[model samples]
Target: MSLGAAPAPGVLEERYARLPAHQREKLNRIADTRRRLDAAARGAYEALREAQDDLRRARAALREAEEHTTRRTGGTLSLRQPDGRVMEFPARPWPPPELAQRVQRLEADVARLHAEHAAASAPAGVTTRLYERLLEHLGLRDLA
Candidate 1:
């Protein structure tokens, strides 16, 4: 029963068999809950990573656009009229305002994803701790 000692073969199975039906059911329920929490946490973590990648791409695009705009003249296209008259058509910046707006939106999305990741991670951690404690309480810490 000591921490350094290993249980004999089939000991775990024997102990589990000796558990009361209600207690076994409760353990199963806790295990199922832990699995669900872990799944949710993984999903949230993936989403967070994806959001961060999207934010990075958005930022890079915005930086490139800004750089292009700064290195170029005002957005204007000129054409020579049929009568030899020069006409200029005014236009927006090289990178439209929408790109900047997209950057802003992506930043917000990254923040939201971070929050969601933390929310999901916290529950998974708590569940793991709870399960560990349950195993210890059942004298099955080795199973952890």
Candidate 2:
């Protein structure tokens, strides 16, 4: 067990297992927190992908609905607002506000999750390498 040499496989884990119970518990908690955070980041990415897909589907449906409405209404579309106002468009009618807002909300959600996911993902192995360096500097690597 040199001061800074890499421990053989299982040697480090053996040493870790020999640590005091409280210290082992703390290390386990730290590892668990990392796993949970990683899982949450993955979930956010999945949700972001789902939101993007929903936005695309919503836009496509809106286009299709608009075309259908135009054909059925002879280029005039009338929509009733929540405030009890009837609004009519003559040609290439605008989408109902609710429908438009649904797409907007999904787009916004995707954007937010994308930013969060990017922020959550640190460069891989950086923290692990840093911890290894710290342990070596402290001469703790000899514990193996």
Q: For each candidate in turn, give its C-alpha RMSD to the true structure in angstroms.
A: 6.1, 8.3
Off by over 4 Å in 2: 1-9, 20-22, 66-93, 122-144
Q: Which window of 10 residues has the lowest lDDT sum in candidate 2? A: 123-132
Distance from true position, residue 91, model 1, in Å?
Answer: 5.4
Residue-wise lDDT of candidate 2 within 1-144, one digit each (tens)? Answer: 354557678877777777778766755654555566677678878888888899999999888766554232777666555566767767553677888999999889889989877766652234444444544554455532
- For model 1, how does the per-residue alpha-carbon lDDT over 11-96 read when each residue is reduced to its tens digit? 98888888888877877888898888889889988988988898899889877645443233367755455566656667565456
The model with the greatest lDDT is: 1
Model 2, residue pairs in steric clash: none
Query: Top TM-score: which candidate number?
Result: 1
* lDDT of model 2, residue 107: 87
Model 1 worst lDDT run, 10 consecutive residues: 64-73
- TM-score (C-alpha) between model 2 and the true structure: 0.58
**Deviation of model 1 at 41, angstroms:** 0.7
